[model samples]
Target: MTELRIILFLIGVAVLGAIYYFGTRKKVDIEDELDFSEGEEDIVSVRPNDLPRKKSGLTVDEAHQAHEAENVQTQKDKIVTLFLHARDGQQFDWHLIQSAAEQVGLEFGQDNLYYRFKGFGNNKELIFMVANMLKPGIFQPDMRTTGLVLIMTLPGIMPALDMWDTMFPVGERIAEILGGKLTDENHHIFSRQRIASMREEMREFDHKHSIQ
Candidate 1:
């Protein structure tokens, strides 16, 4: 009887050991599966080449060429200017200038300067602008200036020649009224030769624009 009981106890111990080993292996397999699932999720969430980047436009050389072309066009469109200066050791009186500008059909408007317009009312187009030679170039009450600048942009609302025709007479009249002398842009005496040259230039400008 004693031998049989000992054999039965040994059998029970072997069965318990098998159950424990299988349960531990199954738990390790489940944990390994969970770890593998988490790794798969991380890989799926990662995206290659997802960062934003600047879109390519012009190349460096092309951009520089474009800038140079714009500058050239701006130079071509630059204003053509003439100056009117008071006689030596003299300055122009503000009241006289106002009256002279008005007589020449210049109206005080934008930039506190004077402008000569082409038409009447809303249809009016700017022919030229006149400003004080002083810094900031605004005409104010009781202002006295040594000179003035008359300016017009090329290819204006009117043909360049016609614009010059209107502008020159207006400058002449204003100078005559104010006892001033009309000069070139550099404030040098405006010679008859220079006047003829300017007229030719204006004609050339008008012709070029007409073809365009």
Candidate 2:
């Protein structure tokens, strides 16, 4: 009985030692495989002249301007827009648009197609955008317009939300000055009822996703 006990104890020790050895070996193998997989990527070779080059040698301001140009459409998508429409049979005057924008502290950006404005409010500098409201199906270099639209937007790097108080008054003021009527996305005349509804929507959206 004593001899049998000794033999069983030795067999148990051997089994445990085998398990530990194989476990450690497998762990080392896995780590090595991971390290190999994560090694630096191989560089593809090209002729010296054929190597990819920047489209242009841009200065700092030029580079920043290029970046902004690329993000124009992206920024446009994230905005709250309000339109000011000219009376029937009247198109917005480009010169008037420029003058009104300047009076309201907006600068002439890019082509006369759009105007840019910024102000410090609510602990941040808010960006305001103004652009032409062209007639439907029109895409020309200098297309005639119904009036202009004000877009409360942020840069591509910033978040988008409804900024009612900040934008509504400005739109109203501009419309008043330009002799145009305020309208919504569907051409509904902007009324107090519409403003209240928009306020509620903005409040609900803010609740779900904080603008900051």
Candidate 3:
């Protein structure tokens, strides 16, 4: 009877060990599966960059090139400038020119009923200005020893073609008032034919860029 009781106790011990081992293993397997599932979820969220490139319409390199091209074109467009020269290699009289410019600004402002013209920069040596009637910063005035060069530009975009009507006329008027000469970038005398050609070129640009 004693031998039989010892055998029963040994059997119970072996049964409990087997149960503990299997339960622990099952728990470990469940925890591992949960971790794997969470890892897959994380991968899905973070792999958006790996999505089909065609679905985004352009690859990263192509997008970057397009942006660069746009910048180049804007620079080119801004370079289409108009100029006015003071007579006989002289610099403009600041007070007289400023008064004439202000008058022109006021007249244009009244006609537009919305846009104003204001000078830019704090340099007492120069009279830099912009079309307040249109968008701010669309025009910039460069005062050199020879004359003032007006570049049609904004911070990052091209100047509007419609602004040419106002800009060129205002420039011519100011030059006339100041006894200055209206000249091209090369200091060539401005003539009817030259202005007509400029207008045609601007129209072409406006058409191409769908500006008007």
Give lDDT: candidate 1, residue 151: 77
lDDT of 1 by residue, 1-212 (tens): 32222222222222222222222323233322211111112211111111111111334564455445545656455356777878877889889999998898899874476878778986766667776654335578898877777877665678888889999988888889988899766556778998999899998887887887
lDDT of 2 at 147: 62
The TM-scores, one per candidate, come to: 0.64, 0.51, 0.45
Off by over 4 Å in 2: 1-78, 113-126, 135-144, 154-162
> Where does candidate 2 clash, by residue pair?
none
What is the TM-score (0 to 1) of candidate 2? 0.51
For candidate 3, the TM-score is: 0.45
Winner by lDDT: 1
Candidate 1 Cα deviation (angstroms), residue 66: 17
Ranking by lDDT: 1, 2, 3
Q: Which residue pairs of candidate 3 clash?
A: 115-133, 116-132, 116-133
Instruction: Tell me how far the alpha carbon of residue 98 in candidate 1 is from the true structure, in angstroms, after superposition.
Output: 0.3
Q: Give candidate 1's error at residue 10 in angstroms.
A: 99
